[model samples]
Structures are given as structure tokens and as C-alpha cells.
Target: MTTTAPLPDAAPANWVDRYAPAWSRPWLRLGRFDRPTGIWLLMLPGWQGIALAGAMAGRAPDWKLLVEFFVGAALMRAAGCAYNDIVDRDFDAKVARTAGRPIPAGQIKVWQAWAFVALCCLISLGVLLTMGPLAIGLGAGSLALVAAYPFMKRITWWPQAWLGLTFNWGALLGFAAATGVIEAPALLLYAGGIFWTLGYDTIYAIQDLEDDALAGVKSSARRLGAGAPRAVAMFYAVAVALALAAAWTADLSLFFTPGLALYATLLWLQARRVKIDQPRLALVLFKSNTWAGLILFVGLAAGAGRV
Candidate 1:
């Protein structure tokens, strides 16, 4: 039996290590199920869209929709991780932080990773089918973005921008699912999510700056270099602005302003606290976006109350 150790980037004492059968550990890790942050980040945009639409409808968020999105997000994020690992296996092998990933470390074969992607996608499709036609179409349209994302670093200095677009597709899907049509507020929320991903993922990229430089990978962190913190602040500011605009476009009440303010303050603190040299702190700030996003969701929901 192959005894798989946790990868360097995995959360310590993650559930996979404690509960997963030994044979399943490699597969679980390959999907990044152990790192729940990515899953949460990916899932939040969808929830935000749902909440925003619900707010516009003057009702509490639809818990059923939330549950559906939770499952869909987890499965899709896992599939995305597997596909990215498959595509970046060579790059992963050269980067210190990513070298221990299942594929690069030889814990899982390339073929198995593909099979896992198929399995996850099939399950996600089941969930997608449960939604309306518009949501399904939006979800299907996202495949092209996902397919192109892994290669963005090889061709552009702004892979994070591509990621911003790809990661926030849920904002569109969630709104369409709830409202049966895409609208301006959803577009605004999607744009806000793109900036949010750009900011946090840049912080995440900071952890890999040295390794990425050596590997010939381009990232906003490397491009911004010493000014990365300021750039993150700028990106986060745009995200907050766009999100506030989205709420206003939805005609959310004044109650949403406080949440937006808190969200902005948190992003400001992250910018002030960021030190590119501190990989641990970078990871902390990157993960902190999860809470920050949740705050924004709460604000959007509160503001959506009956005007």
C-alpha cells in the first residue's frame, strides 16, 4: 500500500489525512479537497449572485439553491484542480511549493487524473442539470475558460486575469439560476468577483514568486514585484467598488453600506499587512479573502432587504 503524505501546500491535519482511506488520499489530494480555501473562494461568487438576486426579490436567500451551489462548487473546483495539475505537471515539478502535488510527485498517474476530471465533471453536470436552461448554458460555456486557464501563465503575464474571468462565472450562473435571466447587477457582481480573484490570487502567487521565476511562469506578483501590495490594494479597491455598485444597481437598501465598508477595511488591512517576502503571511492573507467575501455576501443580502 502506498502511504501518501500530505503535500507541502495542503492544510495541516486536513480531513483527508484523518478520514480518507489510504488508497483514496492521493485522489482526494489531487482534487485539492484537502485545501478547502479554493473551494470556498470558487463557491462564494455563486452564492453572492444568488443572494443578490434574492435581495432584489426582497426575500431571504434560497437555501435550496445555496445547497445546490455548494455541491456544484466543490465538485467543479476539484475537477479544475485535477485538470490544472494535469496541464501543469511539468511546471509543478519545477516549483518547490507545487512539486509535491500528486501528479508532480508521482502519487497519481496522468491518466488517473483525467479520469478523475471526467468523474467530477459528470457529477457536476448532474447538478447543473438541476438548474434552469440559462444557468446550464452558462455553466457549459465556462468549459472553454477552464480549458484555457492552465496555459495562461505560459502566454501572458496576467494569468490571474484569466483566472478572474474563469472563477467568477458562477456569478452569472447563480443569478440566471435564480432569476432565469442575466442582468446588469449580476454582470457587476461578476466583474467585482474578477477583481477580487485577481487581488487574492495575486497574494497567493506571491508564495511562488521565486519558484515561478525559476520555472519561467508569469504572475502579477512577479510583475508587480516590490509594488505588489499597492497593486493588490488597488485591485481590492476596484472589487469593493464594483460590488457596491452591483448592490446599488440592484437597488439594495442603505443597510448594505456597512458590510461593504467592513469588506473594504478588511482588504485595506490585507494590503497594509502584505509582505511578499513572507510566504506564510501571503497564504494567510489569501485565505482571509474567504471571510472577506462572506462579509460582502452578508452586506449584499442585508442590503437586498425590502426597500
Candidate 2:
């Protein structure tokens, strides 16, 4: 029997299972609404962009912009998840960890999944249109990356790096939306966010290393093998350095330094403690990046205030 129980990666009592109507459960599952970490991770870069732009302006980020990005992020992330599931339905069926997904478990049909993707993207487009011309153009351009991301794992060993590009596109868009122009700091933040994704997504991929190998999937975790923790540390180090450079370029005050320090420490702890063999431990460490992102946002906002 196909169980409606929470999937392995989702929290035991996630809202999708707890509150979503039975008829809507499959659609919600397709979007990963139950696993909110992905949503946070995807949204943080945009938040950072807005915060960084606020620092550049020596003012606070616009609350309306935050609300817009928040709604937009959730919609786009849901679209991305549905599209990925559509593309990977066969592969998902073969993997133990993903076999229970709605599509693989026969809870949702492929045509229905595609229709859901279209609906989510259409809604997200309305939010995207609220931004300035530059941001609107950049937001539209990101669709190509989103469309191509699902095939990256099949074609390259470094699909995580591709994810870094696709996921961090919002950093650029947010900056453009806030400032009406892309500047050096936004570029730096975009670059830094790529490395950040590299580090965290590598950690996330650790949970699937065994299954990915059996399924012939490629990932940084499988590429780095047992050296993943050290490599993650290196990636985090580069990310911190680039972020500091972004702060410097934006003229954010020294107050940003301490937050950077704390952010670095968190990444260090994750790198030092994560066990490639322990999928649960890997997941815990992966989720910790939300705090890291928040610390950076606070640093940027405070630094801007003092400046």
C-alpha cells in the first residue's frame, strides 16, 4: 500500500501531511512544501541581495520588497521542485530515498505535475513583474537556468555547481530590484552565494551519496568521496572571503566583521562535525546554513545602520 506518511527527508509531522487536504497531498508533495529548508535556502540569497542593497544605500531594506521576494521565492521554488520531479520521475523511482515521492509512488501523474509547474511559474511571473525593468529582465533570464538544472546531474559531475548558479541568481535580481542597477557588491555577493551553495549543497548531497552512486547519478559528494568535509570547508572559506569583499565594496562598516566571524564559525563547526556516512548528521548540518545566512543579513543591516 502506498502510505501517506511523511517522506524520509521531510520532518515527521510536517504541515503537508498534517494539514493538507487528502486530495491535495500529492501536489503539495510534488512541490516539497513539507521540506521547508529548501525554500529557506533558495530564499536566503534574495534576502541577502536585498540586505546588501540596503547596506549600499545606507538605509534599511524595503519591507514591501521583502514581502514580494518572500512570496516569489516560495512560488518559484515550488515550480522548480515540480519540474525537477517531472524530469527525474524515473530516476526517483529507482532510488530508495526518493521512491516514496508522489510521482514515483503513483500519487501524481506526469501530465498533472507539468500542469502544476506551469501554474506555479505563471504566478511567480506576476511577482517578478513587480520589480524594476532590470530585475524583471534578470528574473526572466533565470528561467533558462531553471529549465536546464534537472539535466545537469546526468551530464556533469558538478551538478552542485550548476545549482549554485541557478539558486543564487536571485542575489543579482534582488540587488537590481533594490538599487535599480547591478554593482560590484552585488556581483561579489552573487559569486559568494555560489560558493555558499557549493558548500551547503555538497553537504546536502552527502545524504544521497550511496543512492546516487547506485543510480549512476553524479554529485560533488560522490566526486569528493570521503574528502567532502575538507572540500566543504574550503568552499566555505572562499565564500566568507568573497562575502567580506562584497561588504568592503559596499562600504559596510566593521560591524559586519563580527557577524562574518560567527558565520564562519558555524560553517567550521558543520565541516568539522559532519559525517559522510551519517545521512541524518549530514541533513542537520545542511539545515544550519539558514542561521549562517541570517547572521550575514543582520551584519549587513547593522553595518548599514552605522554607516
Candidate 3:
């Protein structure tokens, strides 16, 4: 499995030299932007929400709304990562896997990072304004969650729960974007996303368990101890069930059933593959979830377009 190497220079490298100005590379690294997996994870729930909304309305989803959601997801997810790096700079410096992150490795200054975050937020706000007023409001509300997320690990054993809330806000925003209103089905999808995040993030946290423990960081993986796999299974089970419930509540077509089943099978396989004692294996399993999310999205999109 390939992993991104941290930026090499001790001092900030020229933006043009790194990712090239045209690519906006400096901003991307500041947000761990090179990692496509994070954007996919962030965007899938929003897509699922939009598809479910379209299903509820018995219409094909607006393609423009879908495109807008994608753009918003990329910007917001990048911004969130930048915020996390700023907050976790000290903690990141202590962890081998994260020690080379832009902020901690001295490739980016804190205030400059903050400025990057503001710029990303501005871009996200532009996308938000293009959505419904309800979505725009909800998008604004999520700032509180994003602001609080970086500190959750310091104060609580379940930072993944906080992350769940922060990450899944897109579900509500997506539904509003699709239907111009928030509804019960969207709420259910958002709830399910929370559990799904818990499951996957627990697996992700497993990779950092040792470093986290040594650094006095708290996490569900450490809390679950030797029972990490069992806990992940329970979380995934709830996620699958809730996701199906969201679809059913929205009265989606039968086309969604097979996709949901496939997703369930994927989760089961992921659960079985989690090695509580092996951090690298845990990271691998966590990354595999990006595929799981995409598969689920394809199913939702298919179901949204009833023949």
C-alpha cells in the first residue's frame, strides 16, 4: 500500500515548486488535498442524500445540484483537514505517520494555514450560496462542528463520534440541495452516516492507537481494546441497517436493494479483515472503505432513476 510522503523541506517550499500554482498545490497539501480518499468519503454521503431525496420526490435528481455538491464537498473537506492540521499540529509532531504534515513539519506557517482555511471556506460559501437557503444555513451551521472537531480527541474517548457529526453534515446539505428542504429520510441518512463514520474511523484510529496512546490521545479504538473488531462489526451493522431504513423510509425503488446488500457484504468483509493488533492492516482496511462508499453511491444513484 502506497502512502504520501511528508513534504521534504524544513522551510516552506515555493508554491510553484511543489504542486504548481495552476494546480493550487500548496492549498491542497495544507488540507491533505493530494489524498483523494478523504474527498470521496466526504462526498459520498452527500450524493447518497441527494439520491435519496430524488427518490423521495419520485424524480431524477438535478444534475446541477449534484455537481454543486461535489464542488462543495471537495472544498469543505479540504478546509476541514486544514483546520484539523492547525489544531493537531503539536499532536501531529509526535506521531510518526503525521509528523511530516505541512504545519508540523514547518512547510506551512500557522497563520498562513489559517488564511488557506479561510480561502477554502470562501470557495465553499460560494458553492453554498448556489444551493437552497436551507442548505446554505445548514452549511453555515456545520462550521461549529468543524470548529470543535479537532479538540474532541483531547477531551473525549470517541472523537470519531464528533467526526461523524462533522463529516455527515453534507447529507443534510445535499438533501436540501436536491429537494430544497430537509426531511426525515435525509436525517436518517445523516444518522446512518454517523455510525458508518464511527466504524471506518475506528478502523482508521486503530492505525494510530499506539501513537495516540503514547501521546495521551483518546479514541474509540483504544477504548475498545482487544474487542476492536467486534466493536467495528457492531458499528457497521448499525450503519447498514440504518442506511437501508433511510432508503425504505424514502420509498426508494427495489433497484436499491441489491446495492444495499452488496454494501452490507462489503462491510462484513471489512469487519473480518480488521486486525486489532496490526496497525498497517487496519489502515489498509480503512482505505478500502473508499470503495465501499462509492459502491453505495452507485446503488443510490441507480435507484433514484426508476425505470
Candidate 4:
């Protein structure tokens, strides 16, 4: 909101601008700490996975796993953002919203950004090491997806789908950490998360539609254009369906259904309000998913005592 803070999609009067020291603003901005919604978005699916896996096993979500996932999501999401900034520096310079970023604005050198990334990843690695063997393996396997994500816009119009894959890997990691095994229900949850990300990220992409086109970037928002709202609805529908399937297949009890309903209602509302012309609204809708995701997590956790 300040003249000094110019990222188009950044939260209004975010904490980073309000309170962070001037020397640390660039690094914090690089990690997107100003927009903490992304941290919740990244962490929530893993929390939901832990919830679902625990429900199926007749136990509550492991509080320690929830804590671990949050820490890991924060660090990894920061690392991923820094890496993406490094890779997309050229394209970012051409886009209005991203032009003010540390790398593109020359506030930080490339090597320094890389060093920041290394430090974040090193810390996230420490978090991952605390999880079980299966989780550690799954965490390592995700690097390939993370490494490839920056180039996705260049080669594919549906890069949001790839993000769905990358962002939702936490579901599998969470489930594995709780159960020490990957099963059908976990796969269903992961698939559902993919659709969920596709829906929400599409809304996010609307903010960049013009800039992306001008910069020769591809996104589902550009591909669908005015029909993006309808497409988002459909993607959310699939997400809800897969969530139902995951719950039913896992034998989660009746208590879980209402929370799922609440989560679905939130998505439907977001879809109804989504308009390609209203990029600011799109950003708000996209951020709202973090709360919706938490609704589903609470719903899944409720299932633990019943079935």
C-alpha cells in the first residue's frame, strides 16, 4: 500500500513493509514473507494429509508432524520463491508486478540470492531429516519438480497443473510421516490437492494475465481468458470429488462430511465471484483458500474419533 511497496499482488500494508528492518526487506520480500498466505497454502495440505492419515488410523493428527510440516513449508516455499526469482529474473523485470523484486530491481545480486536459497534449503533439509525414512525420500524426490517449475511457463500453458503437483507433494509426505506407508487414500488426497491448486492458482494467474502476455509467458488464465471462472469452478469440483473419494476410501466417519461441505462451499463462493477483469479480487479469492484448506483439515481430524 505504501509507495515504497509496489508488488501488485502483495497484501495491503503487509508486515514486512510495516515492521521489517530496511536491510532485511529485500530478503524477506524474496521469501514472500510479506504475503504469508502462501506459507499457509503450502503448509495446509500437509496438515490435512496428516489429519486424514490419522483419522483413518483412529488417532488425532500428530501435533509434532503438524509443527514439522509448517516449518518445512515455510522454509521450502521461501527457498522455492527465491529460486524462482533467480530463474525468472529476466521475465520478472518485464512484468509490472514482479519488476520491483529484489533480483530484478538489483537490490540483491544473483549470487546473494542463490546464497539465500542455499541457506533456506539447508534449514528445510534439517526439518525433513526429522521425519521418517519414507518422508525423507519423498522430500528428496520433490526437488526434481521444484527445479523444473520455473521453466514450466515457457513450455506449457497449464503450468498451474505442474504447481499443483509440486505444491501438493506435502500431502504424500505428511501421510507417509504419519503412517510410514503410501496408500490409496493418500494418493487420492494428493490428486485432490492437485485440482485444488489448479483452481486457486488459476485465480492467482489472473493478476498477471496482461503482464504475462506482454512478457510472452503462458498461464491457464490466458488460455481460458474470460472463461477462467467457469474453468476454476470445474477444477474445484474435481478437487471436492477427489476429497470425498479419499475420505470414503479411507473410511473416515460421518463427522467429516460437514467440514468437507464447508470447504466446498468456500470454493464455490470463490468461483462465483472470480472475474478476469478483477485481478485484486482474484488475489483475495486465491488467498482465501488457506482458510478453506484449514476447514477441510479440521473436518478430516474430526473423523478420527468416529471411523
Candidate 5:
């Protein structure tokens, strides 16, 4: 049977709800497959890292590596979401938006959720095994970040910051996969992607402010309060600066700047529109970052070749 309705946070008429089989819909939602933006946000930094590495060496991006990273990102993101849901099931019940998630709604049991997470991770590890040792080590190292992320909202006002680190780990991993060693350009790119995640996720948190307040969940959004829009602008500015720094460090073609400019403009638009009261707009702005990230990827790839 079709699921009763889409989760509140999911997009209108999302494909997961519309197209996925009845038995699979709950599992998919448990993994947040209904909201593919998270997958893009998780995946893009890795792509950028691969592209940046390729650009630095004056070579085209490895299509095989790109495909591998995408698959890994999808699986790992699913695993992370399931794990988070299992841990936060109670808190999720108290939050209106999340109360309907598979775990919280009793669509899936805790042990089952754990199994889903493990299945995703196992497949993701299989993908990781195909890469070089440095990338493999980097991939393994990311689990620590992922393991710690679910509890961040309970302990810190800046869970988004932790997520920034977690979501962008792929940058380092991807760079390692391509070059067999970490480099200054990839580090800079990773740092820049952190700030970019910060900005976009801060916007994402706008959807949960009131629910979070009642549940005592701390977040950068709750911490920033009225300062959120300004803070997002500042974070986005830092992101753009760091990205440019990475390109310069890599000695990529000047063509990188144009894409970077467009990337900056998209972030600016998001920062411009965010108002604490406009949760709907916030969701739209948050999802737009996927496109922004892709634009940066294309730009970075196109900018390949030493000037």
C-alpha cells in the first residue's frame, strides 16, 4: 500500500512517496531518501574535492571516481539518517515535523533501524574498499564524526558546525582518492565547504526553531536568533573566500572565478531572503544550495588546467 502521506519536511509529491513500493517507503523515509537535498549536500563536497584535485593536476576528473563517490555518499547519508532517527526517536516524537518519521511514528522498530544503518554502511564500505589506502583511511575516519553528530543538538548550540565537519569529510576523502595524499588545496576546499554547510544548514534549522525551543534542542539557529540572516551572510562570505583561496592554492585556471561568482550570488540570495518567520522560504532556500554546490563543481572542473 502507498504510505499515508509524505513526511512534513519532504518536498511536495516527492518521488520516494509517489514511486517507492509500500514496504520500501518506510525504509526510504527512515534514510531520508524522501529529501534528496541532504544527499546532494553530503555528496557535493566529495565531488568538488575530486574536481579540485583533478584541476590542480591539469587533468580531467576521473569519471569512475565521481561515480564511486556518489554511490558512497548516497549510502552513507542514508545510514547516518537512520542512525540519527534511532537515537532521536523520543525527541523526534516531541517535534511536530519529525514526529512522523518512520522510527518515531512506529513504522520501523529500533533494531530494524539499526539493521538498515548497518546495511547501508556495509555497502558503503564495500565502495570505499575499491579506493586507495589514503582514501580508505579517510573514509573510515569519517565514522567518528557521523557517530557524534546525532547527539550534538543535545549538547551544543552549534550542531550545524559539527555537521559541517561531518558532511564535508568527503572532500578530504575524495582528494585522497584522486592523489593518494592530502594537500593544501583540498584542506582549504574542505574548510570552505564547512562554512558553506554552516550557512545552508543554519537556514535549514529555521524550520525547526519553535519545535526545537520547546524540546530544548540547541542549534546555531536558536543561538543566533535575530542574528541568523547576518550570520549566514558572514558564513557564506567566508565560504566564498576560502573557495577562492583553494583555487589559488591549486593554481587552477582563472576560469574558476566565474563559477565562484555565481556560487557567491546564489548564497547571497539565500542570505538575503531568510527571515525567522518565513519557514517556507527557508526550506526553499535550503534546497537551492544543491544547485549552488553543483554550479561550483562545474566551475571547479571547468577551471582545471594551470594558468
Candidate 6:
């Protein structure tokens, strides 16, 4: 088992010091802002949902709404991370890779963390207020999922399921933002996003598998054991299938079909890479989903008559 030491308490280093503005580093750290991958992952599904909704409605997506969704996702994801860190501070301290996070490393106190969370949430709410009433209500309802997520690991062997529910919420919000209502196709896309999160998050959990076991944390990676790769493949298959069903229901054009095929190919590659258990490989495969998602969004946008 690999054990990560707590990062030293010192001045910000490298690009964090030179490029990141001095005023933002602490708050950024609070939100794991240095890790933009999480933000990208959170935003893509929302974009997909918006694109699909636009396609279904036979119009170009509202660019302002898309921008609003992006801003909201970034703010809320950061806020969610802050809240998660505060809730999991003790557990984070025990996990090597996470032991050096802002909270567990003592760079930020718990109360301060909560305050930061509130600040981020306020910023997010500001963005939410600009959306339609239905979007606002659906967005508010997501709070329950976010609030319950950090505690799921303590009681459930499938906390990844909870994460799937929480992380893919943007799918629902995006559709609502575009159409001002939720419908069957939007719900199907949201379900696909859930399975997508399950597959990717399971790969992510592998990085902490041994640590989680020793620390009494539960994850799908730990539960799946040697069959982890196979399980991921199965979940990805379901995700792709559901996504295709969503595209079909939305009456998307031929352009979207090729993108769906590409996405399925990418999932196969991810599954293949997961079988190797190389951390570096896993990280790369996870990051690749960002590109895969972008491609799918492009296809959807193209089919929706937006360039």
C-alpha cells in the first residue's frame, strides 16, 4: 500500500505562487481549485444535457444559459469540495493522498472551511438566480444530495453510488436551464451521467484502495476487487447505451451517432487501461473522458444547428 505524507506547511510553490494571484490561493486550495479536472468532469455532463435539450427542441442552445451553467458548475463544485473536505477532514488525515489537503494539513480550520463553503455557495446561488424558476427549484433540490454525500462512505459499501447521484446532477439542471422543464429524455441523460460517474469514480477510487481498506473507508473499487475492470466496463457499457437512447429519443442527427460511437470506443479504451492497474495509466484514462465528453457535446451542438 502506498502511503502519502502530509504536504509541508509552507509558501505556495511553482505556478501556484507565480501565476495564481496571491489573494486566491488559499480559497482555491480550500476548493481544490488547483485540480481543474474535477471542474471539467462536473461541467461536461451539464453541457451534454443542454445540447441534447437544444437538439430536441430544434434550436441552437442558449449560449448565455450555457455560460451560466458553466459558471454555476465551477462555483458549486468548488463549494462542494470545501464542504466535503470539512466533513471528511478526519478521514482525509488518515488517507495518504488526502492527508495533505488544506483542512487535514492544518492550513485551514474547520470553521473557516465552513465559512468558505458558504461564500462559494452564495456565489453559486447568485448564478442560479439568473436562471428560470424551474431551474432554480431543481438546483435547490440538489442540495440534499450534496449534503448527504460526504457521510455516505460511513454507512454504505457503495458510496460511489451516492457520488454518482451527486456528481451528475448537472445533467438535470442543464436540461431544465435550456427547456425550463424536465422531461423523459432529460432524465435518461441524467441516468447515463450517473453511470458515467460510477465508471470514472471507480477508477479514481483505485488510487486509494489500500488506504481506504486500512482506514475503514468503503468504495466500489474495494468492493469489486480483482473484477474492478470488468465492472467498470459493464457500467460504461450501460452509460453509453443510455446516452444513445437519449440521443435517439431527442431525434438527434447522424453527426451525433458518430460521436456516440467514439465515446463508446473511448470507454473500451478506459476499460482496457483499467485492467492494467497502473496509476499513471488510470489518471490518463480518467482525464481522457474530458476530451471524450467535449467531442460528444460538439456532435450534439452540431446536430442542434449551432456552430
RMSD of each: 1.0, 1.3, 4.3, 1.7, 1.0, 4.0
lDDT tens digits, residue span 202-279, model 2: 999998987898899999999998899999999999999999999998999887888889988998999899878999
Tens-place lDDT digits, model 5, residues 1-307: 3466888879878998788888999998988889999999999999999999898888888899999999999999999999998889989999999998988888899999999999999999999999999999999999999999999999999999999999999889989999999999999999999999999999999999999999999999999999999999999999999999998888889888889999999999999999988998999999999999999999899888555
Report the lDDT tens digits of candidate 1 across residue range 168-250.
99989989999999999999999999999999999999999999999999998999999999999999999998998898889
Q: Candidate 6 residues 1-307, lDDT tens each?
A: 1222323322234344456666566667677666667878888888888888888877777788789877888888889999999989989999977888878877678998889889889998999988899989988999999999989888987888888888788888998988888888788888988898889888888878778989899988888999989999999999899888888787777767778888889888899778435655666677788877777777677666532
Q: TM-score for each prediction? A: 0.98, 0.97, 0.91, 0.98, 0.98, 0.92
State in Å the error of residue 297, model 5: 0.7
| Best of the two (2, 6) by TM-score | 2
Which residues of candidate 3, in runs, are more than 4 Å off?
Answer: 1-26, 305-307
Is 3 or 5 the stronger prediction by TM-score?
A: 5
Model 5, 128: alpha-carbon shift in Å?
0.2
Model 6 segments more than 4 A misplaced? 1-18, 21-23, 305-307
Better candidate by TM-score, 1 or 3: 1
- What is candidate 4's lDDT per residue for 43-106, written digit by digit as tens? 9989989999999989999999999999999999999999999999999999988999989998
Cα shift from native, residue 156, model 2 (Å): 1.0
Q: Give the local distance difference test score of model 2.
A: 0.89
Q: Whole-model lDDT, candidate 4?
A: 0.93
The alpha-carbon deviation from the true structure for residue 22 of candidate 2, after best TM-score superposition, in angstroms, is 1.5
Higher-ranked by lDDT: 1 or 3: 1
TM-score of 3: 0.91
Residue 279 lDDT in model 3?
A: 81
Model 6's TM-score against the true structure: 0.92
lDDT against the true structure, per candidate, is 0.91, 0.89, 0.82, 0.93, 0.93, 0.81
Model 3 C-alpha lDDT per residue in residues 1-307, reported as the tens digit of each score: 1223435321134333455453355455777555666788888888888877777777766688878878888888888898899999999999987887777877678998889889989998887888778888888899999899999999999999999998888888888877788878888889988999999999989878888999999999999998989999999999998888888788788888888899999999999989888887777788788888877777777676665
